[model samples]
Target chain A: MRSPGSRLRATITSYLLILPAGAFLSVVFLYSLARLGYISVHNGNTGLEGPAQIDAYRFIVDDPLFRQAVKHNLLLLLSVPVVTVLALTIAFVLHEGIRGWRLYRTIVFVPYMLAIPVLGTTFVYLLSLNGMLNSLLQTIGLGSLRQDWLGDPSYVLGSIATIIIYHELGFGVVLFLARLLSLPEEVDQAGRIDGCTWWQLRLRITLPQMRSVIMAFVTLELITMLSWVFAYVYSTTHGGPNFASSVLELYIFNDAFSFQAPSFAAAAAILLLAATTVLIAIQVKRTSVEVNPE
Target chain B: MHGVSKGARRGWLLALALLASAALAACGGSSDTPATSGGGTTSGGKVELTFWYWGEDDAPGANGWLASAVKAYETANPNVSITVVPQATDTFTATFATAAAAKSGPDIAAQWATGPVLTQVWNGAITAISDLVPADETKHWLNTSENTYNGKIWAMPEYLIGVPWVGNKTVLAQAGISTLPTTWPELIADCTALRAKGVTPFAFGNDTYWTTQLMLQSLSSVDDVVQASIGKKSYTAPEFADFEKGWAQMASAKCFNDDVSSVPMSKGTEQFAGGKAAMTIGTDGNVRAWAKTLGEANIMLGKWPTYGSGPLKDYYNATQSTSYFVTSWSKHQKESAAFLVFLHSAEQINAWYAATGTPPADDRFDTTKITGAIDKQLYSFNTTGPQVWLQNFFPPQVDGNGNAPAQQLVLGGQGDAAAAATTRETAAAQWRAQKPDEVKNWSNFHPGG
Candidate 1:
């Protein structure tokens, strides 16, 4: 309805308003991604004197450590379902106003508030051969089951995953609880009035409504399990007991910092990012298919 | 139209105010640098120097000594302001690397002797000390050859770090062994005697890879490995297999603590300190700490047991602990060099002894000044014995990532020594392939000087 001149002027003004945000994204996001890409192909050099060594990728592909790290990352993915189900169950119980729900919520959230490094360190001591856990196990006559918790390669990754789940459960519980509490009371009342059992109400009514939120959380859990487990691994296991519990991030750290081969580190990082993207895409596609049912 | 002109006048004044504010902020940021970098004004302008170091964990009183030294240096040279940054032991190298890669950091930085220092030098992060210190002065320092790269000294050597087997006389006597074993067969027999008395023979933790490194050093000579790394000798040769046999024997003999891989290096040392182990091998600083509990008279430092009666049995796996280097990016090189030289002065030398309870790297350091029973043994071992540390010869990738875990595998009974030796050779080959220049310029130190 406006004149052509005014419409053009308004469009220009709108672009101008967005210019600062666009410029910030370009520098912080796009620039960092471009730098990472360049370093992936270039040889590792602290100074700007080295030539491009595209074969850095080949070195990563041939590395046994890199392969082991990938395998560990995939193995850690198994913990995602365990964490989600535990979180959802607790969230549902709290939403139903179970006895001591407030105390339970507070207790569950306390771990998420604590720092990961400190928690991981405390757990490392607890899980050691002569630690409290083993001592208690011995006291309780379960000494036969006690093993080298952090040292044994068979149990190291699983130990780290358990620590991560303990730390992350609170965040998941609080998140799912917030969504469950926000559901309309009328819908719940209708389901109950229709003679649905508690489990049926949760399964047929409440769970169906939580599909999107659950999917979002599952996606988040997938991403975090894959990438954000470095601190726990570093502080506790150090990817040790003969690389039994090594992860992609630990490999990146060792290659980049300890080994001083940032080029190879960059290549591994890029490959991990690509793999993560593919996984996330597949998850999203599956979620979409479930939603549309086409 | 008059009202619009008045509003535009207000906008112009606001813009000018903001510009002035930003300029003032920029000036304020620049002024804060006097504390960290550029020296504050004194009689003439003072030249501020920043020195970074780490080792509070290994050497107990190092940080306190540094603080006192800085105060003394500042009082002596009023025109110089020195700030000492105490770094943590774990991430010091990585943090320094990040700063070096950015071409900016403290004027002085801490480094390990050869391997770590050479890596930084290759990256152009450090300036050669030869450019700063006089040749006459540098010639008096011990282990200068380790830091020599491309025909120049790249770092200033600090105190010696030696891993010698320290025997607990009380524990040994409990097992009916009065004499310390000097040969391989004798040591194994001693281990059997200790185990019969329900005492752990060699208390070790594989998490930090110290025990594994010691075993590796004992089994093979440094020069042989260096030659193998450079393609002059084959790592798959008979000598390399000695490592596998030695480690497999130790593991099978139950010579180590039951929780070897579970605990860290510190914990294993504690086992020896608690008198649960008859013998343990660790650095001199660690030996000193153990002496506090076990009594100086009760502990005796000796060479690692002879490995299959080789000439290298006389060689000691000793190397300098942490060294210091001036940054290539430092603007006050002359002042920094002066501070570094001042550290070697006789007054600072005494301070080093009083503070660290360890001998200084200065050759002029009088061995007679060391009077403690443990201190005397360490001094004798360092001064009289041959020097070679396996870690100093290999790159971090080969030593840390590859050899450390491979050794753990051998200790854990998952893999044999042959497999570990082969794995280590493969890692060294990768290093040689990737860093051909490093291999080409590698120095193979000899035994017995």
Candidate 2:
């Protein structure tokens, strides 16, 4: 058995190694989370910490805007699977060494590298009622498909999703491609020698190995759909056309800044944090199983 | 105010003490008295002031004017250095609230007049200008009443703005129209004629309820909006919401652009400014900006077509819409106030009008310097009437949650005027529940015509 002093020294060394990240987390994440929780229970809108109460939580839950914003965020989560499938297909095709695969990969990845505000602004213009997109559709003799992409409430969410998917697809593809390339070359050789069809080889061999990465990516994207869409909604619609495009993040911003209801904003933020943390925990559990399976 | 961080919460007890002191000062201070030694310089004999300014959205040349004004002031007073931080239109008040909650920030800041300013005053986030500025200097400041709180001037007015009804005579001529509409019935008829002529009747953007200001044309005073807001009266009442019927009618008549619900204020209004639409509502500065592009002779400046019989219906909705004030925590309160005073100097006053063509919110601004026919008429309409812009009176929550969405419903072809009114009523009820402090404090504010 290790001596008490030696055990204590090892413990101290481990903690010392993690001290920087621990301090960073304490200052940045934990502090902000704690502050958010504290602010949620207070009536700061009237005065600073007027009273600690559940009024903010109760009020936000009853708000129609909050509900609508939550619904919009849920709808955005639908894009997660669509992006994953598209990314997987592209990655598989590129993995097969299709002609000009590098160029195709570059084209797919270029969008993710572009700035969000620039993309959002360009998309807003392209998707406006009389924007370039509709004009192009009209010129291409697909005039029947022309619709107000950003202006119409029914289409605004979908337009935002399309922009997000376009931007995020590259990251997913690159991630899967990295994993695909790293898998032992001998596995592919053995599968081919066993007379496995190309589709079967990829579906049976390549797919199962990426289970953890896929789960991790999906969880990350779900979190993104929940909270990272503020920039997209803000730049394009500002949660307008009668807030048909409002998301939870935009709702929080509106309450905190525009509406002067910080308590409500904090409450909403805490709800978002709770949801994201649960998702992260689930992802951690699933990936841990993959790492140390029985 | 929003954005009270945890770091800010630690200062609440101290802030409450400061609030008590501010309340004491409000009760006892005179306009001529200097409440604190704010003009004090540091040991290095240098006074630095950070000014958070807004209104460049309404006044395009304001940024340029402020830069020149700052340079001149720094040259004249070598001991003081000033930094102008232009505030974003979307987060103007929130950023300030975050700073105020922290109890340290810009020495000077701008906020919308009355309801927005008074909320800050109650929170003890600002210093009353009457304490920092002299009675003689502020006596010349017109519309100081807009920022008055507990018998002290809480904020300083810089310029007056009115939403003037602007028409393109050339565009109107295309529809065989000679006179701009002056009544509700006439506006409908003209809209029909304009529509028949393949022209957009009134270019407006309702994306954020900015167009809802026109609904205030029916309310008589600030108290009317206040009463409706606090549930003493209903927002659904005929007098309060009747204007929305005209808007709904206008929308049904297809008087606005098809994209009215989707576009922002600048884009929708630019359709008029760029000569694509016939008429629109605009600030005096916007009126001047449009005139430059659409040609001076082609522009028609007038009041909103009459709809309500309220006392303020015929009067122009004109006042100091936004103003600057010194922050409570600023050490350079005196130097900041000094800069504000210099802004109203005769040279600066003339320069303001000349550069902006917007009438300065001071009594000393010479009116004759206004040469444009539209400018002269705008000045007369502003000065000769009771000026009450209703949007400035309501809490911003009601503006964002109630009026904006209600207007959005009608414009988007989703709901009728009654539905719109009910939306406002619901928003008001919610705000009253959320903010009882503001509602209780409103008893002290009796704004009159």
The TM-scores of all predictions, comma-separated, are 0.88, 0.89
Interface RMSD of each: 15.0, 15.2
- Give the candidate number with the greatest DockQ: 2
TM-score of 2: 0.89
Give the alpha-carbon lDDT of every model.
0.76, 0.80
State which docking tier applies to candidate 1.
incorrect
In angstroms, give how far residue B274 of model 2 lies from its true place.
Answer: 3.6
Which portions of model 1 miss their true places by more than 4 Å? A1-15, A44-47, A288-294, B1-46, B94-106, B123-127, B149-152, B212-221, B327-334, B443-449
Considering only chain B, report the TM-score of model 1: 0.84
A144 Cα displacement, candidate 2 (Å): 4.1
**B355-447 per-residue lDDT for model 2 (tens digits):** 777888889988889898888888887776677777787888888888878888888787898998998898899888877877787756777
Q: Which residue ranges in model 2 land beyond 4 Å of their true spot?
A: A1-8, A45-50, A140-144, A193-195, A287-293, B1-40, B44-48, B78-81, B131-136, B329-335
Residues A1-294, candidate 2: write the lDDT tens digits: 999999999999999999997797566545555556666787664235656544788888898888999999999999999999999999999998999998999999999999888898888778876678988999999989988787778898999999999999999999999988888889888999999998999888878878767865786688779878888888888887778899988888877778777777777877776666565556555555564464
In terms of lDDT, model 2 sits at: 0.80
How many residue pairs clash in model 1? 1
